[model samples]
Target: MKGVVILGESECSVKDFPDPVPDVGEVRVKMMATGICGSDLHLYHMDKQQAKKRGERIPGHEPCGIVDAVGNGVKKVKEGNRVTIGHWLGCGYCDQCAAGNIMWCEERRGYGGAIDGSHADYVIANERNCVLMPDSMSFIDGAFIACPGGTAYSSMKKLDVRIGDTVAVFGLGPVGLSGVILAKAMGGKVIGVDIIKERTELAKKLGADAVVNAKEDDPVKVIRDFTGGKGTPLAFEASGSAKGRTDIVSSLCRGGKAVFVGAGSSENVINPGQLIGSQLTLMGSFVIPLWMTWEMVDFISTQDITFEGAVTHRFSIDKASEAYRIFDEGKTGKVVFEWS
Candidate 1:
């Protein structure tokens, strides 16, 4: 098997590894497509020690593949099935898992850094974490839907996105773009904000009714202007920057709701006075719940939202280093690594 690894800061290598085998309750998936996410760049920029910890750990989380083998006690899927691997999995018996919130699992294993991830010819995954990919979806789109798509869907549902709602997305990355697509499909007028001109343009193409280039204009002012000065009813922060979170919270209508989906800095600047006086609802969104995962899949499939435009670049696994370089430059849209 050939897998990509992060060696150190600005250093990456694709090397050979032993073929992965399915353990009990697990399955061996023949990698078909893996999406390169913003989180993957965190590993690419790691220092000597973080890189050391990432040694031999294949660095991809959003993977879709064909199940080549299944282990004992597995029942959710079978061999020859196309599936999307969940990056995070908890003990199946945990109350959280039973309740469909795997993010709150007691023994949660986000299977990228500690456990070998999907940037390879093969990967071992817990059967509970594998969602059977619908035949209607392509492997490339299905790969990203596992994470960015699922996260966007979960947040939109939590924000109570609805018809006639002005929804603003504070970042134009993959997650932010996905947010625009879903919000529009659900009948909300979508506004996308991003510092990068290319990203904003891409957002507009995807589904955003309007896009604000934060570098050229004030996003808060532009968003409010578009919404007739009342501001948006729902907003999402996907930039993973404190400033982005500020824009999301500040650009809300009275009694509006905002969900911060990005993992920004430890501390962010938000006005408690505004939060209280405006009766605004602010909350953090995590991974998708099991029930919502199905909803998201169905919604995307039926709505014909492929997010294909967001996937602006593709690379074979051999060029993993180059792939990360372009992604870290932050100039492109979604990037995917294809194994087949």
Candidate 2:
């Protein structure tokens, strides 16, 4: 098998590695497509946060593929089945797992983060972490079942953005775009804001009623103005920017729910006073629950939801370095590594 590794700061390479095999309750997946997540880029450049936490990593979590082999006790799926690996790996026997929130397990882990991820020819996954998919779906689209869409679903579930409510998304990255689409699908009037003009336009294409280029204007004011001076009933901070968080708090209607879906640096700051005065419900959402991931996959499968825009760049297994460079430049969306 061949895989990529980030040895240290500015040091990454692709090399041959032993192929993974399924153990009891595990499955060996022949990785078909893997989306290059932001964490992957952060690890590639040895960003301070990931470097400090987990040095020299193989970072990737959004992987979709076919089950090449299944170990004993894997009753949910069998060989040759198409599937997407969930971002979180949790113990199935824990209380958290029993309650259907396996993502909260104390022993939770994720591919490409805590372990070798989909940036390879094959990866081993616990049965509980794999969601079987239909053969009709492409590997690239299946890959989204784990992250951008899953995260969006989780945030929406947490905030409970209902029909007829107004929602604002502060960011136009993949997750933000996913938020916009999900909000619209749920009957909310959706508005999207971002510093990048291209992403704003893309947001509109993804069902946002309006897209604000925050770099050229005040997003908070723009959202307020668009919402008839009342502010949105629900707002999501998906940019992982401190400024974006502030705008989410400011642009939310009194008592509105605000969901923070992006993973930002630990040093990020927000004004406690503003949140208190606004009476806003601040929520932090991470990976989606496995059940929610399945529901989201089913939801999108029903629509012609295109994952095309999100996949802005693609590279072969060997050009792993260039993949990180393009992602870090912020000129593309979900860059993916394709297996040849």
Q: All candidates: CA RMSD in angstroms? A: 1.4, 2.5
Compare the candidates by lDDT and give the number of the best one.
Answer: 1
Candidate 1 TM-score, C-alpha based: 0.96
Assess candidate 2 and give its TM-score to the true structure: 0.91
- Model 1 ranges with Cα > 4 A deviation: none
lDDT per residue as tens, model 1, 1-340: 8999888787799999989879899999998988888788788878989788656778888878999998889887799998887777777887888887877888877767668888898989988777776798888767867788888888998888879888999888888988988899889999999999889999988878999888889888998899899988899889888888888787899998998888858775888999999999998888687666666777777877787788888999999889888888888888888876
Best-matching candidate per TM-score: 1
Question: Which pairs of residues have clashing backbones in candidate 1?
Answer: none
Model 1 poorest ten-residue lDDT run: 290-299
